[model samples]
Structures are given as structure tokens and as C-alpha cells.
Target: MSNSSLLKTAVLAGSLLFGTAGATVGEEADARKILGSMTEYVSSLDALSFDFEEYHEIVTTDGERLGLAASGSVALVRPDKIRVLRRTGYTDTDLAFDGQTLSLTDSDAGLFARHALPGTLDHLIDTLRDDFAKPLPAADLLTGGGHGGLTAPTAEIKDLGVGVVSGMLCDHLALRGEEADWQIWVAQGDTPYPCMFIITSRNIPLAPQYRIEVHKWQAGPVEADFAPEKPAAATEVALADYLKGARNLPPNFIVEVEK
Candidate 1:
């Protein structure tokens, strides 16, 4: 797929959990307020860390839809420092940005890439999408820089009331966009943070979904070590080359058998 298509697919696919219940005006307003609170509270934090479990549905060439799972952890410090580590069945990767430079490493391939991109976390997200044609899932919530970044494209909103995620009670919300539908569960009270997020493609044939569940959320001062440690004997290559090499890795999803 083309870069633009990739971005759209990622955005749409990144858009999942919701209910079919109709919402009243008051409930809609309440839902919007809850989402806004989450944005504000997450953005205001100086540092935070969270573990996430991700599920992505992929359509195979034969038109079979299969699910892929990955787990990762994210650590961020306000202004311009962040580290993301993801592990899948096929590969283990690390992406780090330390204000001045961006580093990506594929431990399985023994290859790494570095680029100079000096700016805030928001700028980093834009560069990744526009320049590098990369997708950072849940980026809006993670960076929390752009106002209404998540809700701006929303066409409708619904309050699904409360739901439990990992045994924690959360306020559930469902949102509809032009090309996607998404849901979020925000933990109630003073520290309003997202406990779970899901995005489902509305335009895609199979309506594939991408889901993220946050676990072990920690907010406060954390070590700002965004620079990734380059593995010994690993080859350093251009960013584009690293991305190309990554595309050749083994498929991350498994095909389901007919029951």
C-alpha cells in the first residue's frame, strides 16, 4: 500500500470496544467531558509509564482475517523523551527518542537505525507519519500535545456508562469517525487515564480492529533514559533501510483454521 493508504489504514485500524446502546444528549456531553479529562490529565503529567497488550487483525491474501498479538511498554518524559519496546512472535524491537536523535533497533535482525530529529514528542509523531511513513499507535493520547487530536475527527459520541477492565471500574465511551469507530475506557476519579482503547475500521471489508489494553499504569517522575543502548556488533544503517529490512521479517499473525 502507498504511504497515504498505510496511514489511513493505520488510523482506521487503530480506531475498537463499544456498545450498541443509544445515548442521550446529557450522556453524550458527559462522555465528551470524560474524554477531555483524560486528555488533560495525561498531558499534564511530567512522566509516566505503562504496559500495553495490542491485538491487530490482518487480512491475508486469500481473504482470511487473522489476529496478531504483541505486548509492549512505553515510558515517556514530557517535552521530548520517550521509549517504546515491543515484542512479537517474529521480532523484538525498540524505539527511542531523546530530544535530538531517534533510534530504532531490531534485536532479531541485529540491525539498528538512527536519525537526527530535534523537537518535542508531537513533532516526533508528525515526522514518523509524514516523513518516515511509520505508525505510532495511540499517539494522540501518548503525546497529548495537539488539542482535540483524538476527538477532532469524531462525528458522533456515545456514553456507554461503566465497564470493568482488569478489575478496575472505568467509564466507557464509544466514538464514530468518518472511516472508523473507536472506544475507550477511562479510569474514573482524579487521575483519569485510559485503561483500554480500541479502533475498528469502518471502511475495510472485514472491519479489522486494533485494540490496546493498558496495564500497570504509573504516573510520576521517572528516569529519562530515552537513548537506546546499541547492541554490540549490530550493524548501523539508514532509517529507510532498517524499515525495509523489517518488512521482510516473518509474518506476525497466524491463520485461523475452520472449526
Candidate 2:
């Protein structure tokens, strides 16, 4: 055979053998192992709190990408109570669930709404998404099943080695779903909390991105932390009415569609 043809044949043989071996190795690359450990730690906590900085990217009709930044804090108490405070240049929003009632307040508009909801934190997370079309900030990490529910539909998970985020070493994981791509950096060592999260809407026009960077994390938050401070003069309305006003506001993460 010609020298060039022999080299091509060797390359083909090597690739076929290596491809099979690579698949075998990739099958064992279950990043879920790390995620499961983190979940166990998170679920075992009676309470938790974290501070985060978040950003959202949007593509204008002119194809220009615009980014917005916001900072927030989250507190969670297992089974029921949770609270979140988010501040942006445009608005100050707070959400609190005290095991019996769920309240939402937007200080920029001087409006507040409360709805009775008695359930676990997981149920609260689902209700906000299904009923109100609102996503609890960084909730995928706080949900009862933790990464389980969030990653159930993911088709591919890859370990992207180790990296440093917010001054802590982390195990970087990348996941690909049918519609989106996500990356998470789980802190290393005894505490495996996720220190960073990024999601890209691959199906969108510009494939816009949303990212959250965690700064502070703590466990065992007190019960009083979940209480919402309702303004005395703030207007109260039905959940639907409250959402009508909120529907125009930018969400913590980008929704599939924009109004």
C-alpha cells in the first residue's frame, strides 16, 4: 500500500479502538456522584443561607446582547421556610415563605401579596414554577431532591476538572439537556455546595446566558430570618393580580420567552 494510505489505515484503526475505550470511560463520568454528595449535605441542613450575584443576558431585535446585574441573598429552612431578597437598579424584590403563608413584595412599586401555602420547600418550589410561572432564585440547588430533579432530564454530564471560584476550589461539571446547557462548580472538601452556576439557552436566538456567583454560604439560619416585613400601607391584592404587575418585571433568570 502507499505510505499515505497505510498511515490513514492506522489512524482509522486507532480511532475505532480508542473511541470504544473513550465511551467506556465517559460512561463512568457520572458527575452526579459529586452532586449527590452535595445534595446529601444540603438536605441534612436544618437551615441555610447564601449571598449571590446574578446576571442575565438578552438579545435585542438588533442582535445586540444586553446584560443586567443583580445581587441577592437566600435563606432556607428545611421542609418549609425560605426567604430571598434581590436588589437591582430597577427594583427591590423580596419573597418569603413562613411555612403557612408565602408573600411577595416589590418595594419599587409599593405593592405586596401573600398567599396561603402550607407545604415542604420542594412543594413551594414547584408551586412557584407551575402556578405562578415564577422560578425561585437558585432553587435547583435548594430543592429537596437537589440535583436529582434538576438533572433528571439531562442527557449528558461531564466532569470539567477542578477550578477556583470565589477563592474556593471546586469540581466543575457541565451538563447538556435537550434545550439548554448548564455548568456548575461544586465547592470541594467537606462542604460541597455549588459556588457558581451558569445556564445557556441554546434554543434562543442569541443563545443568551444567565449566571449566578455565590459569595457567602452558611447553615443553620434561625426561624426569624424567613419572616417578611410587610409595609403597613402597601396595597394587597390577589395572587393573580399581583402577578399581573410582576409579569412585566425582569426575572432572576431568563424565561424562555419575552413579552
Candidate 3:
């Protein structure tokens, strides 16, 4: 997407989310159809690459809101290969999964960690979220599941009609889950792809949010994208040991110990 389009999309998204009209039943049904088609379309891909900008909102103890931003890219291959790189003001990190092992690199710190794991993309997400408390960048949209498992019984969904995202026209859909409320904008037409996603934490004060804007997409990703390049001078460390001292390993990064 071009810079002009991205600006337009961002402006339109803000207006729609905070100022749009209420949704009708027909709009809701259309949203479901569009999202279902999008899931199918992404599932058929053998590999994919896209650039993303992530934003995080935090509420301070005194009720002041602060925002943080990061930009990154994701590369994925079906079954069991993926890579995500994110750069923030303080650090740059990369996570890679190669079917057999999951590796994380803290480039600025010259530290790397690896864990023995074998699974599909879905399994990797589950492991990261459940055990490591690390959510993959835009995992909900790109995963091979209907609406990325957003159609839960407890979720209240609605379609917010046409909106722009990354300068592309999109169908906006909102979902209120038990813990979070999320909105997604997917491009329309034969190649319906997601352009943006925003999630608000309902359980937190002031409803802090995490927003992601997708800037570009590629149909196929080369092997090098998911393959890790270990720095010769980087120290090899255990996942636990590495995470112990790691700061901001990712927004929700946590190391869990099992009894």
C-alpha cells in the first residue's frame, strides 16, 4: 500500500470506530461472509509476507494514557515455519520457528535462545501464548481457522460496513470477546486480505488497546525469510535463562514454569 492510502485508511478507521452508525443484521451477515472467504483465501497460501505497524496503549497509575509503537514484518510457510521481526526504539528482536525448534534473537543484546519444539503454525501459536505468554504478530488473522476462532459463543460480533485501510477499501467487523474487543478491516473483492486489526483489553482500566496496520503483502516467502542467521558473536542461551533477564521480550512476554 502507498503512503497516501495508508494515511487515508488510518483516518477512515478512526472515524468509523468512534463515529460510525450502528450496524444492521444484514451488515453482520455480510461481514461473516467476507471474513469466511478471507480465511479460506489465506489458508490456500503456501507462504506469505507482510509489513506491519503495531501500537500499544497503556494506562498509568494516575489514569494517564501512553502509547508505544513498533514496526515489523512477518513471514510464514504452511505446516511449521514462521518468522517475525519487530523493531522498537530500544531493541530489535526476531522469532523463528523451523518445525523442530523455536528460536528467539535479541539482536541488540547479542543474545539468542532456542527451544526444541515441533508443530504446525497453530501449535506454535498455542505454545507461545500459553507457555511463553507471547502473542504472535497478527496471529489471529493469518491462522488457518474460521475467523481465526473469533466466532466463539461468548463473542458479540457486528459489521461496521465499508472503511479504508492502507488506502484500500475494506469491510470492517467488530468482535467483543470476553476479555477483549477487536476490530478488523479486510479488503474487498476477489483477493480479500486483512488490512488492519485492533484489540482493546476490556479487563484493563481505560480499555488499553493494541493496534496493527498491515502495510504490504506478498504471496510467497523465500526460505531465507523463515531461516535464522545466528550471529557468530551472539551467545547461545537457554530459553528460560535468556528470558530471565530479557526486558520487553515482546509486549506480553512471560516465562512460565511447570510443576
Each candidate's TM vs. the true structure?
0.86, 0.82, 0.83
Each candidate's lDDT (Cα)?
0.83, 0.79, 0.79
**146 Cα displacement, candidate 3 (Å):** 6.1
- 84-108 in candidate 2: lDDT tens per residue? 9899877888899888898988887
* lDDT of each residue in 49-161, candidate 3, tens digit only: 88899998877667877788999988888879988989987778889998988888887778899898888888888877889887777887677333334555434578877
Off by over 4 Å in 1: 1-19, 145-149, 247-249, 252-259
Count clashing residue pairs in model 3. Answer: 1
For model 1, name the residue pairs that clash: 15-199, 15-200, 16-198, 16-199
Poorest lDDT segment (10 consecutive residues) of candidate 2: 19-28
Clashing pairs in 3: 5-167
For model 1, state the Cα shift of residue 39 in Å.
0.5
For every model shown, the clashing-pair count is 4, 0, 1
lDDT of 1 by residue, 1-259 (tens): 8999999888777663333578788988998899889888998999999999999887776777878789999999988999998888788888999999999999888899999999998889988887877877668668552522366767789988899999989999889888888888999888888999888897988899988899999998776568877788678999988998774235654446678
Model 3 spans > 4 angstroms off: 1-21, 144-149, 221-225, 249-259
Model 2 stretches with alpha carbons more than 4 Å out:
1-30, 144-149, 247-259
RMSD of 3: 7.2
